[model samples]
Target: MPAEKISSLDDPRVYKFTLQKDKELARDQEIIVDSPKVVLRMMDAGRTPKAILANQKFLDDHGQRFEGMDCQVYWADVPLLEKIVGHRLHHGVIALAERPESLKLSALGHRLLVLNGVNKAENVGTIVRTCDALGVDSLLVDERTLSPFIRRAIRVSMGSIFRIKVRTSADLFSDLQTLRTSGYQVLGTGIAPDTHRFDKIDFAKKCALIIGSEGFGMDSALVGLCDAVIKIPMRDHVDSLNASVAAGILLQRLGAI
Candidate 1:
């Protein structure tokens, strides 16, 4: 039987038609093309369809195909994306995607990092990258933390955001109690004169590192709840480091490097 042709974008039958390898190759190679929506995954070095759409002439010619559907054109190359997103790297495509739902804290365990009130998307992204690099078991984001999958976060993380398990919390203190009950040691970061160095903390035991925001630092209530509060020693007038930078330092101190 001859395969049916798709006549309309809205037809449910249209999804059933699979593009053959040759056809897919042809589509990928075509200089000007259109789709209902173009999903970009990374903005690395490459000739992307997104790049074409940024051009007025090319968009004028091919933009009609993407008409009526949500459209985003990446006129700026990788450097421009980096500047706009506040991160240094983008893997050539930025995917237009649905936001993923958050997981529950009850569903997590093992080595975990809790982000408290860290609002900078780039910081969130960098921590995610460190977590993945260190093989940390999971990530928990309090209400104040930025979404790990946001464009700047994704770009900064170099896609490591997808590799880590993430959960959200309305009350991080309550969540800390749950982790404590589950035999997880909750450690908070601080730089008071009496605090222990992060390297002295035993990470071989089940643990969670509570990282605070870039500006205000962790809440005192949360700090008091920790099994221990630790800090990384520094030189000069550096009173502190960026939350993400501190996270990487702590991870390395814990032998995660």
Candidate 2:
């Protein structure tokens, strides 16, 4: 039997060499790139030598020609890297690659999840992760929401944020109107008495579930724009779940339906 070839980052064929600022290299080097490239570097804080070596070995064996360029490797201590990136949690490994394009609402095949005023990056990341898990077609981020690509959100989502389609709308209300015109049933989440139980809704129909901020529920005008208002039944003193948690639950139920 022939020895199978192993791809390595060191292979000149595996990567494209480029000059990047040392600061940008640490924050999210992998995601910043335009191609399928991984950035390997040493972090200043709590440097994990074992992880770094492991990453190097893996990159050497499996990395594709990084757009026919060289892989960049940088060295920095914990304090300097943190100062450069404006945050501390690099986990000793970061890579930037081309992310899948955000899916347009018109191109979506089934149900959608729309986020409004959900500014917390972690929550946004969680919702995206859930969307991927529940087989939701796409995610819509209103202009007021946080960026799902932020490092913290990406970390919290375990990179699932990259797997799902994310689109932003400057005028969310107008976007909802467009969805309605396209025959999507816009379902808004809230606690009002008139809201329908989540289980009662028919998820088989092309639908869009709207989740509002943790502090404020959906905007009144947006709620009125939805085809229906839905709520998850809860017990104990729980009035509501976190935006991400609620979204996950709703998506799961919708998926089951």
Query: Each prediction's TM-score against the native?
Result: 0.65, 0.70
Number of the top-ranking candidate, with TM-score as the measure: 2
Q: For residues 1-257, what per-residue lDDT tens digits would candidate 1 score against the true structure?
A: 11122233343432211221223423343212222122222212121332221323334454454454443443344344334333443223222333345678766657789898999878988888888788785898887787675545765776666567788788889989988988888888888887788767676467888898878888888877788899888885998998888998887654352
Task: List ranges where model 2 is wrong by over 4 Å.
Answer: 1-90, 96-103
TM-score of 2: 0.70
Whole-model lDDT values for every prediction: 0.62, 0.62
List, residue by residue over 124-224, the lDDT tens digit for candidate 2: 87887788778885788887787676555666665566556677788889989988888888899999778899888776477888999999988888977
Pairs that collide, model 1: 40-94, 40-95, 42-91, 42-92, 42-93, 43-91, 43-92, 43-93, 44-91, 44-92
Stretch of 10 with least lDDT, candidate 2 = 42-51
lDDT of 2: 0.62
